[model samples]
Each structure stands twice: as C-alpha cells, then as structure tokens.
Target: MTSDTVPVPPGGEILRYAAFTTRPDGGNPAGVVLDASGLSTERMLAIAAEVGYSETAFLIPGRAEGTYTVRYFSPLLEVPFCGHATVASAVALAERAGPGHYVFATPAGEVPIEVDKDADGVLRATLTSVEPHVEEAGEADVAEALALLGWSPEDLDAALPPRIAYGGARHLVLAAATRDRLARLAYDFDGLAAYMTARDLVTLQLVWRESEDVFHVRDPFPVGGVVEDPATGAAAAAFGAYLRELGAVTVPATLTLHQGDDLGRPGLLHVELREGDARVRVSGAAVAIP
Candidate 1:
C-alpha cells in the first residue's frame, strides 16, 4: 500500500490565514502548512480537508532558500494552483525566513513569489503569474454559463463581451453593466459544476468595471463546492490578461479589483501588466485569521 492512503483531520492541525487584505476578516481565507516535508499527497489532502478552506497551501521545502514545492487542495478536491494560498504561504514563510523572493514548483507550473515588508514592516506577498491566455467563449458555452448563473446576455455589458480566461486555471469572464447586477448572484450549482467540469473551468468571473483601472468582481466556484469566492487573485490576473488581449487596457497599467463585499469579507487585488511581458502580477497581504 502507498503512504498516500490515510486522510488527515480537517481543521485544527492546520493554520488559517486571509490573503490579499490586511484585516483578518477581509481577503480570501487560505490554509497554510509551514512544514510538509514528510507529508504525502494523501496526508496533505487530509490536512486540507481538516483546514476546511476553499484552498489550503502545503509548503514542502522546510527551509526558505531553495525552490519549495506547494500543493493546493479544497475541502472536496485538489487544484492545479491556488493564488490566495500561494500568497498566504509566501507571507507565512517570509515571517519566519525573512522577506525575499522564493520560487514555488506547483502542479500547474513554477510560480515565483516575493514577500516584502511594507513601510510599517508588515510582510506582504506578491506572486508573478505564469503566462496567461484568453479565449473567446462560444455561443453554447456562454448560454450554458448564463443559464447556470440565472443571468442572461442582456445582463452582460455590451462592450466587455465574454471570454474564457486562464492564468493557472480556466475561468469564464463575464462583465455586468452595473455593480447592482454583479452583486445579486444566484446560480444552479450542479449545472454550473457540470458545465465547468466539461470545460475545465475553475470559476466564473462576474465583474463590473467601476472605472478604467478599478473593477468590482465576484466569482462562483461551483466545481469546488464553493458558492462564491470573495477574492480571487488568479481570476483577477486572468482578467487582466483578458483586458490586455482585447485592448481594453494598456500594458504597465495598475488595475485594482475589489471583491467579496457582498459576503462582508471585502478583499482587494492589485493586478499589474508589465510593459514587455504578457504575464500578470498579483499583489496582496496575508492576515492571520486566528
């Protein structure tokens, strides 16, 4: 029998941290495992389930200098990459190892993360995303998404259109004309999960552009048993690429995305598109939830 057999408990053994916002009540909550060298995949999954967050991060390098390995899992299943967890893990590592750049080899790819102290010396984590790509959402895909979301194309912003965006995971990006439209979200969970599974989607990025550089966003994560994600750095990074590809925004632009207010856990995501690279940069802070 393989060592990846037994499952671990769900919550107490793990640490919880909110990423991308300073307040513990704000930002996206993530599970952080500081040391996971001897832990197998099964053990990690068990720990994640115990942690009970949408995504928990397992940091497996023991020390802080070399490239570390990270694994992300939700209560239900594992994912390729999780931005909030990555940020949380990076910041957690920084607190102990001192702030600096650290490379993470994840299931999705090699993710380079940097943790730095702010003016107040509070450590914040930033992750440079893998090369992201965007694709046109087809008529059938759009219709299916709308049906699952209890929304119609009429509710969509005429200018923004629809697209499947990717950084580490695939997400359908839909724009609402008003924040009110974006706020009131309801969806058929089973149907949405089925549609997402078929398309390999991770979440649905329902957004309302507040200004040229500011946006209000919400995500429905049916595939992972999450009704909604208040703040999603990965989706935000993907959305930045989508905007760039559509000429909606210029490179070297600093984009601000506000998420999770409807859930009362307001989180902020900052996306930067560099002048020469197509990959996006997502920045945020990690706050200890306990």
Candidate 2:
C-alpha cells in the first residue's frame, strides 16, 4: 500500500497499477485515474465500467508541466491507445510526480512517457510507440481470425506471417506454430467481437517464437471487452513493429515479450529496437496493486 498511501475511491482516485509485472499479482491490471479533469464521455465510460480493469487510464492534465490528456477506457469502448493503461499511467505518475519525462496526449498519437527508478527501487515505465504500420492481414481477415480462434491454416507461423500491427492500437499479428498453439485460448467471444468490430481490431497478438530474442505472447482481447490481456502494452508496441517489419528483429533489437504465462499472469515485455528509430520502445515493471 505504498505509492504514498494511494486509495481514495468514491468519485476520484482509481490508481491500482500492475502493468508489466514485478509482482502485485504479475501484470496488466491498470485503472489509474490521476485527475480525469472533467471526465464525461459518459462519465469516462462509467469509470471504465466501474473499474473492471482491462484498461482504465484517464489523466487529462496537459497544458505543460509533464503533460497528460490521456484517455483509454475499455470495459467495452473508448480506446485509441492503451498498453497496460500506459504502463499503469506511468507508474501512477511516478508515484505522484517524481520520476522523469511524461507527455501522453493519446487518441492514438504523441505518446512519449519515461518514468525511471529501477535498481530494485522499481517504478519502470517507457512507452514511446505511435507511428507504426504493418498491414497485410486480409486473406478474408486471416480466414475470419482463424475461424474465431479455433485456429487453422495449419496452426500458422510460417515464420510469423499474418500482420496487422500498428503501435498504438490495432493488433492481430498471430504467429503460434506451437507453445501448444499459443496456449490454447478458446475464442469465439461473440464471434471475435463481431470480427473486431468490422476491422478496427484491438487485440489478437497471440505469438510464440521462443528464440531469436525470445517471445511468447497472447492477447485476444475480444475487442476490449476483455477475455485475455495480461500485459499487452499496446500489443507489445505492435509486436515491436511486427518484428521489425518481419525481418524478425535485427536493428538495435531488444525483444523479450513473454506475456502472462498462459493466463497465470506472468508478464514481462521489454521490446526495444533503436538504430534509426521507427518508434516502438515499450519497457515494463509497474507494481502497486494492493
């Protein structure tokens, strides 16, 4: 219960971190409210469906200082960028304004963020995506998202080839030629939430590729109504730009990504990639979920 005794509740203080793990039940719990200025969008989608947590950031401060204006809610709507609620709202604003850089602006752009504090003191953050692309997933939308996840096309992964990336929101990468077919996640959640609301898609990363910089993800977010999303970090920053546009990592590389161990909540998503940066950074460590 640290982070300066965070708790409030009633009509304000949401907090509740967890992002990419470091305990506090592993990762991906989000729901920080910070200030949420005048909040509305139907009361921030009713406080993100009463803080159910698949995402729930809300900020709204910007005009200088560290900057904010974030949004993200996903109990069933409003999402333009989430990434474990922007790393649990940048370590809940670096435990109340302390860590470094910040900037958020989001509706699918200007992300920035930084935080810092590690050496065991914890509090990591990172962010940085937005300005990613990666199309080519239409083969009838990858056979209707592999027939709503009962999977097929020979369990995929012919060297990771399904794409639909995007670093701030749209996902749908696929992969999975094992790891028990990406840990058997039963899908069909309302037919993949009506096939990801007619193509905007929000999750379905689902990888596997335990080598070349290690990997193993899983997202399947039934279009944000949530069914699975333990530590997405915007689909690990659109799968590090779909593994460097499918060259499968090379540039300054960093990768790692090992999302929520088959749902027992394991979490860990470093993913770097520098050398002439094309966006994608995504770090991790965010606790305070007591």
Candidate 3:
C-alpha cells in the first residue's frame, strides 16, 4: 500500500466534538483525527470503531496551506463522505489555524468549507457539496422501505414522495404525513440494513414538514452501525436538492432542519439552495465536547 499503510501508535490523540449545534450534548458527535499522516486504513478503521460514533474523520495535511486529504470511516466501514464529521473536522482545524477557508479532498470529490465565527464567537462551518442529483426510488424500493419502517402508504406525504437523493452520499428520502408518524420511528433494523446495503444507501432520511421553510428530521443509520444519527449534513444537503428538483420549494431558499430533538440531542442544520446551482450548501455550528 501507499504511505497510508503506516501504523498509528497506540494512545494517539482523538478529539470528540459535536456538529450542527453549539452545545456539546446537542448535535451529532464525531471523532476527529487532525494529524493522521502515518495512519493505515486498518488503524483508522479500528480507531473509528473504538470511537463508537456514527463517523470519524482522518486528516492528512497537504503541501499547500488550508488544504488536506481527508478520509471518513463509520464504525463498520469506510464511507465516501460524512457531513457531520466534515463540519466537526473543519471546526477543529479552525480552532488551530484560525477561522478561514479549507479544502478537503475526499473520495467523493473536493469539498470546500468556509469557517467563520458568529457574533457570539461561536464557530460555524458551511460545506459546499459535490454536484447533487436525485433519482427515482422506484415503486418496489419505496414499498420495501415502508414495509421495513412499519409504515403504510397513507403515512407518506403525497407532496414529498419517495426518491433517492445524493449529495456526497446517497440517502432514501421519505417524508411522513404528520409529525406524530415521524416521531414514532420503530423499524426492523436488520431488514432495513439489508435493503439499504443492497441499494447502496447511507441512511433513511425520515422527515416531517413542520412549516413552509422548516422541517423536523431523523436518520436511521443501521448500516453505519448506529441506531440513529442526531444530525446528518449529507442528508440535509440531499434534501435541499430533492426539494429543488421536485419543485417542493422555490429556488434560492434557505430552509431550517430541526433534528435529534426526539432523541434529546437537538441540533439545527441550515440548508441553502441557489438558483441554477446543482450543488447544495449545509451550514451548522460545532462545539468541542468537554
């Protein structure tokens, strides 16, 4: 293998942080390894499993400043991209390098991130996703998803419909007709995992429209070896593309996503869609876990 085959020493530092929310206990927690230059893929995978979060990011510094080669790993396997982990990693970098722009070369593509502090001095990150696109989920796949989720046809929102959305990763978007239906999420984990794996899906984006520009969302991430994800940046980006493509929301719109409230780890995600822009922008504030 390449230099990535070098082993990582035991007791190497790992940083824990939450993304998409300023509070430590609110957003999705991710493990950040800022200096993973000599880490092998196997070592990174083991570290990620030990972290026991939905995802962890490994950073290998590039020759140029503010640029790095990044890799993401779930507890079970390597993923092409991870939104929360990216935000967490960017915030971690900003803490060291000061707030500015950073370029991450991921397996998916080059992801540009902007880091700036809010008026309250809280660091926020905005990641511009790779070119996003939506594909029809098809009748059979939607039916199978509903069956595994223990939901029926009437439970789906007619306006939203079922579709496979992709930003940096692919997610199956299913909108519930009511907030109650979305809140009562009990699913056949093994069955859903199998189905999702077969179709190369990252998570099931379960959503409920709370208002014209606001939504409540949840992510079932059995494939990542997590029961659920409190805040999902990739899914939020895909959802923005889904809305624009389906004409559900007008272009140049900024939508707010409220997630993890049901799990008691409430996080907020801001999604922006510009007119004639295929890529989506997902913004959130992240904080170190103390």
lDDT (Cα atoms) of all candidates against the true structure: 0.85, 0.84, 0.93
Q: Which residue runs of candidate 2 sit more than 4 Å off their true CA positions? A: 1-46, 50-54, 57-73, 76-84, 100-124, 127-141, 146-160, 163-171, 174-191, 194-222, 225-232, 241-246, 253-271, 274-290
Model 2 Cα lDDT, one tens digit per residue, 1-290: 22234333334577788888889898788888888776677777766777778878888787899888888878789989987888878887888878999889889978988889978788888988988988888798898889888899999889889989989888889898889978888988989988888888888888889899988888878777889888888888888988898888788988888888888889898989898888989998788877
Q: Give the range of the ten consecutive residues with the poorest summed lDDT in model 3.
A: 1-10
lDDT per residue, candidate 3, 1-290, as tens digits? 12243344343668899999999999999999888887889989988888789999999889999999999999899988999999999999999889999999999899999999989999999999999999999999899999999999999999999999999999999999999999999999999989999999999999999998999999999998898999999999999999999999878899999999999999999999998778999999999998
Root-mean-square deviation per candidate: 3.4, 15.3, 3.2
The number of clashing residue pairs in each candidate reads 5, 2, 0
Q: Write the per-residue lDDT of candidate 1 for residues 1-290, one digit (tens) a residue.
A: 12254343332246688988999999889988776767777777776666667888877773557478888887777888888998888887787778999999888888898888989877887898888999999998898888878888889998898999999888899999888889889889898988989999988999999889999999988777789987898898899899999999877799999998999999988999988898888999888887
Q: Give RMSD (Å) of candidate 2 vs. truth.
A: 15.3
Q: Best candidate per TM-score, number?
A: 3
Model 1 clash tally? 5
Instruction: Please name the candidate that would achieve the greatest lDDT relative to the true structure.
Output: 3
